[model samples]
Target: MKRIVIIGGGPAGYEAALVAAQLRADVTVIEADGAGGACVLSDCVPSKTFIASSEVVTGYRDTEEFGIHSDGLEAVTVDATAVHERVKRLALAQSADVHSKLVKAGVTFVAGTARLGEDTLGHTHRVVVSPHGSDSEYAIEASIVLIATGATPRVLASAVPDGERVLTWRQVYDLPELPQRLIVIGSGVTGAEFASAYLAMGVPVTLVSSRDRVMPHEDPDAATAIEQVFRARGMTILNNSRAEAVTRVGDGVEVRLSDGRTVTGSHALIAVGSVPNTDGLGLTEYGVTVADSGFVPVDRVSRTNVPGIYAAGDCTGVLPLASVAAMQGRIAMWHALGEAVVPLRLRTVAANVFTDPELATVGVSQNEVDDGRVPARQVMLPLAGNARAKMADLHDGFVKLFCRPASGQIIGGVVVAPRASELIMPITVAVENHMTVSQLAHTITIYPSLSGSIAEAARQLMWHDEE
Candidate 1:
């Protein structure tokens, strides 16, 4: 049996372990955190759970518009502590579920920090695991080593998290009470998500954007819509402002901007970005190439320069989505174990920003088209034109499709609506299979549905082709 060792137990690590084990390979997963890593135990699961609570509050507040009147609406309030308690409970349970799967797959689980080392012969790879809260160290020699150590939230020196007033994305769940006025720095996905959730929960939120607009990486149309929604909900957006420092003031925190201005709030969340957890792993010593930012360099097949040492997930500096991480992990295992595998195609990967009226995208983006990287025809159908959206009181987004002008093949698409995450799947499939716009238009879609907008967008593209 081929022995495989996976470092880190996040989506990438755990998924790789299970795949390797099922292939009848001896698999071991060494993780410093608990099983499920930051995605499940800290970042993704916790934040989504918190967002769910905010979503419930938003639904209740919108009930009157739906012709439902209830006396409880006026008195409804979020218990920050209780909400966090549920978040923690759900995260732990999900972690336990991943652990259970790993156990059932006959994969050895070790709670420890892992480092790369050479075997006694100095020819094969070996992992030295230093167990958490203990000094006992053990080494596991393996034919293949997969690095999936994931990443941690990047923090500025001036905005150090105190776990009380100033916070990182991971530290938010531990709060004892909700902030009366919350300031979220950085207008990327993480920053926008928290700002939206808190605003929906009735917390006064100020979003500080270093760029001129929020989510600078997203399509301009989608970003504009989200910004409009945010401002419409009483959110104070500081555009073209950069946060220089965060300091405690009496009962709140003051964020000093680069332009000689300051914004004070009861608490501040630093959602700048993330740093990959690839340091101190002896990667350089093992002849593995690591980028200056501490992310491992890997190819499409998830292989590092050092043969038999593959890296996946956030540590590899690929797209940081959990789904992409899992795919990379599986591809790494399949390649290493001599199984049939396909190299990762990033264009087909779908991503979602979990805010109110989520923004989901797949295939080519509008920026790509504008930059002349992707020559395509584009069409957008407003959700307001959809019967279901009108009935559901949802009218903040659209479905945009990008297709090859000559052949009408669907190349990419974006969905900006409630549950855009789900709506983008069909578009993603169409892009993946190189399906034509006509095919998508012909696909049966329920009338009066958001997906109908997708079909409508495709039909619009078909009309453009005819013209």
Candidate 2:
């Protein structure tokens, strides 16, 4: 029987364990953190759960738009303690769930950090597992070794996370109370999401973005819409400003910008990005090629340059998303087990920023089309015209689709609205399955639905093609 040792228990490691076990391999997963790694235990699950609470607060604040009386009602207030408790509870529950799934799939779980052992270059490799807070270690022999150790929030000496006044994304939950004001120093997905989330929770937020706009990687129009929404909600956004350092003030924090200005807030969140957890992994010692950026260099099949070894997830730096990590892990196992496997295709992968009025996208981007790299026709339908969006008071989003100019094949799409994550799926399906604009346009959609805007966009594209 093939023996597979996976290091890390995030989406990549756990998902791969299930697959390898199903293939009748003896699978062992070594996880230094909880069963679901930082993603479920500290990062993705906890953060999203906290964000969901903030969304509920936002919904209550918007109740007046639906003619619901806010007068003579108990004022809604956030209990940071309660919110953090629930967040941690749900995260632990999910971690337990992940562990149960792996066990049911006949995969062994090792609670420890793992590294490549000597003779790792051989056909069969050795994995050294060192349990936390222990000097004792053990070795597991494996025909295939998969590294998915993931990454950590990047910390700068000038802006260290004190877990109270100054914070990293991970330390936000540790805060005892809501800050009088929050200064988020990074406008990428992490920074923007937190800024939006805190603002929704009735916290004054100042987003310090080094770039010209928030979410520079997202669809430009979507970014503009969200940024506008942020400004409208009284959130201050300082663009083209880099934070040089963050220092403690009197019971608050002060951020020093490179432009010789200072901004003060009760708390500061450093969302500068993440660093891959690649050090001390013994990858280079075993002859596996790792980039200077600390990410493992992998082919589409998730294989490293060295045979009998593979890497996946954030450690590979393909895309910093849980879904992408899971897919990469599954692909690694399939390829390792000698089963028919398709190489990872990132183009069809859907991504979402979990902010209020979430932005989601898939496949070809409008930037590529505008730059003439992709010859595609584009159509956009404003949600304001959609009956459901109007009923729901959603006037700030649109559905945009792109199709091949000649073939009318759906190539890409973007949806910006409440739960855009859910609405982007149909477009993702069309793009992944190579469905045409006509096919998607003709698909019946329920009336008075935000998703109907997607069908409308497709219809407009088809009409243009017909003309």
Candidate 3:
């Protein structure tokens, strides 16, 4: 039987190990940070758990419009301690569940960090495994090696994370109490989502963006809508402002900007970006190509230049998403086992930013069309006209579709609304199946539903293009 060693027990490593075990291979996973990596134990799962609470608060705040009223009731106070406890417990529970699954699949779980070394059979890899807090290293042999090591929040010396007054994305969950005022630096997805979440939780928030607007990566209209909503909620927004450094003030924190502007807040959350965890992994010695930003270079099949060595997840730098990592893992296993496998097709993947009015997108964008890469026409439908949005008081979102000008084939789409991730599936399906906008327009969506707006947008696009 073939022996396989997978490093980093994130979604990629765990899922790949499961597939290898099913194929009757002896599989072992070496993970230093336990199961689920940052996605479950720290980033995605725990953060979403807190966001779920924000959804409840938002629902309660908007309940009065539905003719429901508590005569003298006020906004329910948030217990940060309780929230932290639940977040940690749920993360632990999910991690335990993953561990159980690995056991059931007969995959060996090694609690350690793994580095690739010499190959035993030109195909067999020697892995140096060092357990956390231990000086000893164990060498293991594997016919195939997969690297699923993920990324970490980038830290700058000017604004180091003290895990107290200044915090990284993961450390914020450990806060004992809500900050009197929280200043978030960076207006990207991570920054915007956290700012929106805290604002929804009734915390005073100031979003500092160096760009001209928030969510600069998203659609212009979508970004505008989010900015308007954040402003309307009494959240302070500072744009065209770059933080020079974050220093601890007497009892709070002060962020000094490059333009001689200073802002004070009880706490500061850094969301600039993430650095791929690639160092000290022995990749350089093995001639593994790395990108300028230090991400491992791999082919679509997740194979490195060296034979029998594979890399996946954030380390590959394809897309820093848990779902993408899981898929890459499975694809690596399939290709390794000589089974039919398809290369990673990022254009068909759907991604979402889970803020109040979520922003989700799939495939290409209009910007690509304007760049003369993809010839496409666009159509957008405002949610304000949708009956469902009217009932739900959702007036600040839209669905936009991009399609081939002549073929009418759906190429990509973006949906900005509540649960936009779930709503984006139809567009994902259309893009994957090459369904035309006219065909999508014919599909029946329930009346008085936000989903209807999606179809309507496609219909409007079809009409305008007359394709």
Candidate 4:
């Protein structure tokens, strides 16, 4: 039986270990922290739970427009403490669920630091083991090893996370009370989502972005819509502003920008980026090549240069998403177990940023086509024109489709609407199956639903204005 060892208990590692165990391989998973990784305990689950609370409050605010509310607006009070309590409870419950699965699958669970041990085949094939508690360090001989150590929030030299005044995304859950003036730095997906959520919760928000607009990696039109909505909600958005330092003042925090401007807030959240947890793994000693950013270099099959050693998830420098990580882990095990498996394909990958009105996309982006990499024509249908969007009181959103100019083959698409993250699945399927724009246009989507706009966008592309 092949002994397969997985490092880190994130979705990637746990999922891979389960697969290896089911294949009858002796699988062992070594994780320093608890199972479920940061995705569940800190990042994805916790944040989404908080957003759910904020979304409920936002619905109440919209009741006046629907003529469904009469009075009691002055008596409404937000109980952030209660919301946070539920978030923590849900996160812990899910982590326990993951722990149960690993045990039932017959995978050995070890809690401690893991590293490379004895190596063979020119330091390619190696032993991976770790020390647990005070007991003597145990060693596990692995015919194959999978590294799925995920990432942590990136820290700036200018502003360190204090878990109080200055906070990281991980520490935001520990806040005792909502900040009267919350300042969020970085305009990426994490930043925008939190800022939007807090604003919906009735907290005054100030978004500090070094770029010209928020969600710079997304479609420009979508970004503009988000910015407009934020401004309309009384959010103070500071663009082209770079934060130089963050210091805690009396009862709050102050942020100083490079332009010699200073802004004070009750709290500051640094949603900059993430750094892969790759240090001290003894990777180089095992002939594993690492990138400049300390990420392990792996092929499409999740194989490292070192034989019998593989890496997946954020550690492999792949797209940083829980869904992608799970897929990568399965692919790695399939290849390592000598089963038929296809290489990883980024072209068919779908990603979503869970901001208000969301932003979801699959396959290629318009920027790629503009750079002449993928030849395609595009068409956009505004949500304002959709009957469902009108019924749902949505005025700002759109569905844009990219297709081959002559053949009308759907290459990629973007959707910006409420729960666009869930709505993008059909577009992902269309891209994966290589469906045409006309095919999407013909697909029956329920009327008076936001998904219908996807079909309408394809219809617009089918009957384009000729030159």
Candidate 5:
């Protein structure tokens, strides 16, 4: 039986353990953090839970839009402490659940940090597990090793998180009270998400964007729509401005911009980005090529340069989504264990930004088309034209489709709407399966649905093909 040791209990490590166990490999997972890693324990699950609460707060504010009248609407309030408590409970519960699943799968779960080293003969790889807060260490011989240590939130030296007045994305959920004025620096997905969530909860939010627009990496149209919504809803956005330094000033925080301006708020969130948690793993000694940014370099199959060693998750410099991490883990196991495997095709991956009227996209994008990287024709259908969107009073988003001009094959799509994460699935499927616009247009969709807009976009693409 093949012995496999996986470092880090994040989505990638745990998922690979399960797959390796199913393949009858003797699997052991060494995780310094609890099971489920940061995704469940702190970052993704916790932030999304907070967003879910904010969505409820938004729903209460929109009660009148649904033709429902309630005298107590004015009395509705959000309890920040209670909301945070719920987020913590849900995160912990999920971590425990992942632990249970790993145990049930018969994968050995060790609560420790792991470093790669050579065996006695220097012919095979071995793992040294060092339990947290302990000086003792033990070594395990492995035929295969998977590294999925994940990442940590990037913090600028000029702007350090005090975990009080200033916070990182991971530190926000533990706050006892919501900030009256929340200033989020960095208009990437993390910054935008927290800003939008806080705004929905009735907090005054100021979003600082170093770029010209929020979510500069996203579809331009989608970013514009979100920015419009933010401005209309009373959220302040400072574009083309970079934060120079953050300082605490009399129970409040002051963010000095590069332009010699200062913005003060009750609390500040530094959402600049993340750095891979790849340090101190002894990877360099073992011939693993780590980038200057500490990210491990891997092939499409998640293999490292050294034989029998693979890397996945954020440490591998792949897409940072938990789904992508999990898939990379599975792919690593299959490829290393002599099983048939498919290399990751990032184009078919769906990514979502969980803001109000969530933005989700799959496959190629408009920028790619504009840059001439993808030879595709595109069409966009407004959600306002959909019956369900009208009923829901969602006038802010659109469904855009991209297809090959000659064959009409669906290449990519973007959906900006409430629950856009769910709505982008069909587009992802179409892109993955190489479905054509005509085929998508022919599919039956329920009346008065957001999905109707997707179909309509495809039909429009079909017409464009004809023309």
Candidate 6:
């Protein structure tokens, strides 16, 4: 059997390990953190779990339309401690499940740090591992090596996280209680999600954005819709404001902006971005080229510049979504083991921002179509027009579809609504399969469903103005 050694136990790394084992290769995974890596332990799982709790409370808003009133109950309140209890519980359980799967798949799981280089015996195709909780080290010889070490949240020198008043996205769960007024710096996906979650849970929030709008990287219309909701629900959005420093003052924290202004809050969350966890991995020594930004650049097959060295997940600087990372991992294994491989199609990748009214998209974006990148006919239908949306008393968000003018082939789509993440799947499938708008329109969706808006948009897509 061809031997494969994978570094990191994240979705990318563990997924690769499972694929390698299925291919009948001897596989080993070395991870210093838990089996689920930072994604499950701190980043994706915990945050989403916390958001799920917040979303429940968000539904309580405007319930009077459904004959529900606050007079029936004392008040709807969130217990930060209880929410975090569930967060940590689910996170740990997920880690354990991933660990069990790796073991069941016959992949050796090693709790240690891995360095790519010659072993003690001077074997160039060997990895030196410093086992966790032990002083001794060992070496493993593998015919192929994969690096899925993921990334770490980037920390600013001027604004350090105290794990209390001032915190990073990863440090927020450890907070004993909710902040009186939470200030979220950076209006990207992470910042927007946290701000929306907290606001929905009745926590006063201030969003500090360096850009002119929240989620500048996302669709403009989508961002505008979210900003409107945030404002309507009493969120203080400071667009075009850059945080220069975040320092604790008394029991709270203060953010000093670039323009000599300060915003104070009980806690400050720095959601700027993250850097690839490439240090101490000896990537360069093993002939793997890393980018200046510390990311390991890889192609669609997840192969680095050097043969037999594949990188995936956040470390590759591809899309930072967890689903994309898992796909990259499977592609890497298939290519490495000589299986019939289909290259990763980035265009069909679905991305979602988990907020109050989630924003989900796939394929081409509005910017691309408007900028003459992807010429297509488009239609956008408001959720207010949907029967189910009216039943739920939901008025925000829309379903948009884009199709080629000549052939009516669906090229892209966007869904802005509650459970938009789930609603985008059909469009993602339509785009992935190169289905035409007619094909999608002919399909039946439930009468009282938000997803029916997708079908409605598809029916009207080909007749709309071409970009």
Error of 6 at 53 (Å): 0.8
C-alpha lDDT of all candidate models, in order: 0.92, 0.93, 0.89, 0.87, 0.93, 0.90
Residue ranges of candidate 2 with Cα displaced over 4 Å: 72-74, 120-122
Model 5 residue 461 lDDT score: 85
lDDT of 2: 0.93
What are the C-alpha RMSDs, in order, of all predicted structures?
1.2, 1.2, 1.6, 1.9, 1.2, 1.9
- Candidate 5 has which clashing residue pairs, if any? none
Give TM per candidate: 0.98, 0.98, 0.96, 0.96, 0.98, 0.97
lDDT of 1 at 178: 87
**Candidate 5 accuracy as TM-score:** 0.98
lDDT of 3 at 393: 84
Better candidate by lDDT, 3 or 4? 3
- Residue 375 Cα positional deviation in candidate 5, in Å, after optimal superposition: 1.1
Q: After superposition, how far is residue 458 of candidate 4 from its true place, in Å?
A: 1.4
Candidate 5: lDDT over CA atoms? 0.93
Which whole-number lDDT from 0 to 100 does residue 219 have in model 6?
A: 87
Candidates 1 and 3 compared by lDDT, better number: 1
lDDT of 2 by residue, 1-467 (tens): 99999999999999999999999999999998889999999899998898999988887666787889774123778899999999999999999999999999999898889999887445799988898888998898899999999999999899988898999999988888998999999999999999999999889999999989999988999999999999999999999999999999989999999999999999999999999999998999989999999999899999999888999999999999999999999999999999999899999999999988899999999789999999999988888999998888888999999999999999999999999999999999999999999999999999978889999899999999889
Q: Which sections of candidate 6 miss by over 4 Å?
A: 72-74, 119-124, 463-467
- State, as a TM-score between 0 and 1, how close model 4 is to the true structure: 0.96
Q: Going through the candidates in order, what is the number of backbone clashes in each?
A: 0, 0, 0, 0, 0, 0
